[model samples]
Target: MEKANSSVPKPRKTSVLSNYEISVSIAFKRDCEVFLVEFAKQKTLSYAKFANIWQLKNMSYIFADQTYVSLLKTLCEECFAILTQCIIHQKNVYMKIGALYLLYGLYYKQPIEGMVKIRVSYDEYTIIKDLMDEMAKEKYMEPLFIFAKLKADVAFNYVGCSMPRSIRFIKNTKKAFTAHTLNANFGENPLSKFEGILQDESVVKLQDTCKRYEMALKKNSSIYPNIDQFKSTIMDDLNAAHKKLFSEDHSTPSEQIETDLKILNSRQEIKLRALKSENATYRGAKQVLTAIDLE
Candidate 1:
């Protein structure tokens, strides 16, 4: 038999995220869910404008939250995996770059107003190297290699490690090559930012949701209030959250039910109904989304 051609690159098999990675993706997706719920509740702005509010700078609470250390620890644990999924598995460009920029920012994230910035300690710097070479094997990912190189250099610098200067990419890149991404403004994509905002898969979805809501607001200027109220009922739409409460297996408790339903008007009634629905559900946002997301 004739040998298969060696020149052609074989198709890359899709990488499956591990259970840990899946859990991370889902936990990472949690805030997005909450934003989506709130965004859908908003009858105030267009999608583009609405998305601006969700930016990390605007979300001042995250930096100040008592869980900041825990959150940073979690991101340090899974950021490599998150980057891998974004580069190899994620198809949405904005989501992909959002991951890139966010990871890049975390490397040098600065403290502000006594709230700590993102960091992986010297002991944890090795995490950045875990999947970098694997992702860099392909030529198209050269930019990613350079991105990783820059990040790794920061780690080396942080630890006061000295490195020799080296020759660079010459054979592969063309003289005409230039990064012209919208964010680049005709320059190479920095892939990192000094004071970047928080962005990720969920943010992108929330932005899409905003676009959808924006259209609805324009289409139903008067009825959008009702639409927003109806949309708020999505919390109970998750089956796992209400499994025992609504199932034949169990009976819902009355106090578990918020018996204190007070309504001053029709709007209050709608909101009260939403509050009651939320009360009946018993799962955290991460757990709810994790149960539904494909593994």
Candidate 2:
């Protein structure tokens, strides 16, 4: 058989995420979920607003809670995966930081996700303390403020040696975080400080979360590279987390049966009473009209 035009656009690599991309997409989705819940409750944010929040410099206002915090943990793993995948793919660092930026808003709602929630060695504690002190002294020195180059350096240092050796490939992850953090203006979506006070407590919680995640990323000092395998492992963990969270097992209340019946009967009776009242008004109006005609 003839080699029927071998160059016929050999199926453009439409599927780009790979196992790594899938994981990253999931991470982005988690961040989206967090945003949707907080935004819905607050009725203040939209997708465009979220994009702007990721681009803003002064991010004191965005925040979330425990529900969002759990959601952020999933996103964080996804961020790590994206960072590693980009390195392997020789992709841009900007893409990776963009992912982190999105997480920033979600984490802002629940700072605990990025916090060093677990106990660490004295050395690790010292590192974190110093970083926080750095942030305290110069808010601009915050991880979100720095260039992607330095940000990746910080990420490597922060999670490299500290996390398990099984995930050691994370160290290879590089520059994407810094690129996106620095380059994209994604445009500023302004938020008010007085508005902050007027805002729901949930907003405060989410913003605090962003600060915590930034802190943790800064505190980490290990220079570990990203490993592709970690994506699958973490994906499994995330699935488990989701399953654990959404599994509803509570029984319905018995009082609901009687209450529902009463409500239905009362509604029907009310409608009948309303119809009778309307009939009386019409009859009274007709009698008035009849009397006027006779006169």
Candidate 3:
């Protein structure tokens, strides 16, 4: 309901175009409902067939008029509701498979000017997740994979909206770092303890060992490093440059996959200015003007 806001001004009720949309919407809804039933049984549908039901072509005179907007949302809700019922309530696996294909087509099909868009509410998606988990517990994983395209992709449609996403953070370890402090790394460091070797080796011998150790590190050592006697010398100034650049408040080098997830799952921004801009200049990718008035 929250995503139902319209930037396009409501058209005059008495206008000829507004009056025409009423009949068009009525017929469109009837045809769309019929398509669902046919597709569920047939297990297949073509774009040309569905596009005719959608009623708008890429450059059709159709735009976001009042009746058109109501129909826009209604089609999505009805299709999803029926599909959910078929998947959850229907006992026949073949019927359920047909229903799943119907949904798959709805979500992935290229509609007329992208008009036949399908969006799943948060509560609705949870039903599928619970079903998948139940199926997994019982050792039936095939049916679950059949629904992967929809279940996996529906999260992208839910994010930045009122509905919370169902799948998030494919992999996360909770290092809790940010660019402000740049804190990172987790778990024990391989080189955490630094016990200095109290060997009686001379400075010149230690320096020679340090060079040998460096070569050994890169697998370029002519012979074995043999620098255990100069352990302290090998780390003579290990933290010196790092200490000068950063503070004692530091951590081990850890990997981050969460930052990318954080960016992808970020909340949507309110675009007040975009609401009043030119059609192509704003988020009006599918916008249609109803009257002479401008935004």
Candidate 4:
């Protein structure tokens, strides 16, 4: 009698790509084939080539088509492998830098989780990381400084805080007058009392330093300014902000405040550095592309 009450098992669920997704996959594969053909001949990638191969429309398909996603992962791995080889073999610096630009573009295009994991031996990872670090240390600072300014805006928004009119005034001041004006009037303003409450040192320093870097970059377009300047400036700003926010006289800060501060300092620094390095590589790629007519 109990056997008579048994129910039928349900069928396993499966996903299928839509007709549009299938078409996207076909178009993407064709593009990859074209890119591979060019890559085979030149043994390097360029910004224009990469932009042509990786169209914005194709990128939109990555999330919708599992097959396309897998294909993209495969493509990224192949490019990364080429990058590793370029570095390991000590190939032409221009080619190596070009490969790096392509790799960064791919890595930044989609979410890391969606992309294939970079499968590298520990030693390989170390070598690549070291190279990247060296490059970052010597990267142009203007882009990073600009990123820092944007980071400050995001950080203030994170903690539901807004800059005072005095800070805004400092930001809008002419570059020649900014530093002097800030030094003289910063502490005297009524808003200065709220600096501790607002935790605006990082924002202020970021804007000020960005302006300085902008001027410097404009003056010396050929020189690759060291990124260490930005790091030092931001670190000092963060330290000052930290001391103000958690003065010895104050009670222990809440976990949220601590987390936000960490994000503003560490995460923002990491992001700015990465952006700087990527941009430098991209610029180098453009130069190399111009040197060698791919047509």
All candidates' lDDT scores? 0.39, 0.40, 0.44, 0.44
lDDT of 1 by residue, 1-295 (tens): 9999999999976322233334555554444233333333333323232334344224333324434554444444344333333333333344333444444444444333332222333433443343344345533354365466555565323332211123322221112211221122212222222112224555456656766876677679676456552343332343333453344433222221122211123456787787789546544543445555766
- Report the C-alpha displacement of residue 115, candidate 1, in angstroms: 15
After superposition on all CA atoms, how large is the RMSD of candidate 4? 30.3
Candidate 4 overall lDDT versus native:
0.44
Which segments of candidate 4 are over 4 A away from where they belong? Answer: 1-72, 110-113, 136-295
TM-score of each: 0.25, 0.23, 0.28, 0.26
What's the best-to-worst order under TM-score? 3, 4, 1, 2
Task: Output the TM-score of candidate 2.
Answer: 0.23
TM-score of 4: 0.26
Q: Candidate 4, which ten residues in sequence have the lowest lDDT sum?
A: 155-164
RMSD of each: 23.7, 27.8, 26.6, 30.3
Off by over 4 Å in 1: 1-25, 31-63, 67-71, 110-149, 152-295
State the lDDT of candidate 4 residue by residue for 1-295, as single tens digits. Answer: 3675347777755323233334543444334333333333333334444343344225334434345555555445444444444444443433344444444555555544644543455565456556656556877343234324433433112211111244323332111212122111222334335446434676667768768886776666556555333223554675677676556545322333344445556766887898878336554456455545866
Model 1 is weakest, by summed lDDT over 10 consecutive residues, at 172-181
The most accurate candidate by TM-score is 3
Q: Residue by residue across 97-183, what tens digits does model 3's lDDT show?
A: 445555665545423344444445466457666767776787665556657765566422542432223332222212222221111
Candidate 1, residue 20: CA error in Å?
Answer: 12
- How many steric overlaps are in each model, in order? 0, 39, 0, 0
lDDT of candidate 4 at residue 248, scale 0 to 100: 54
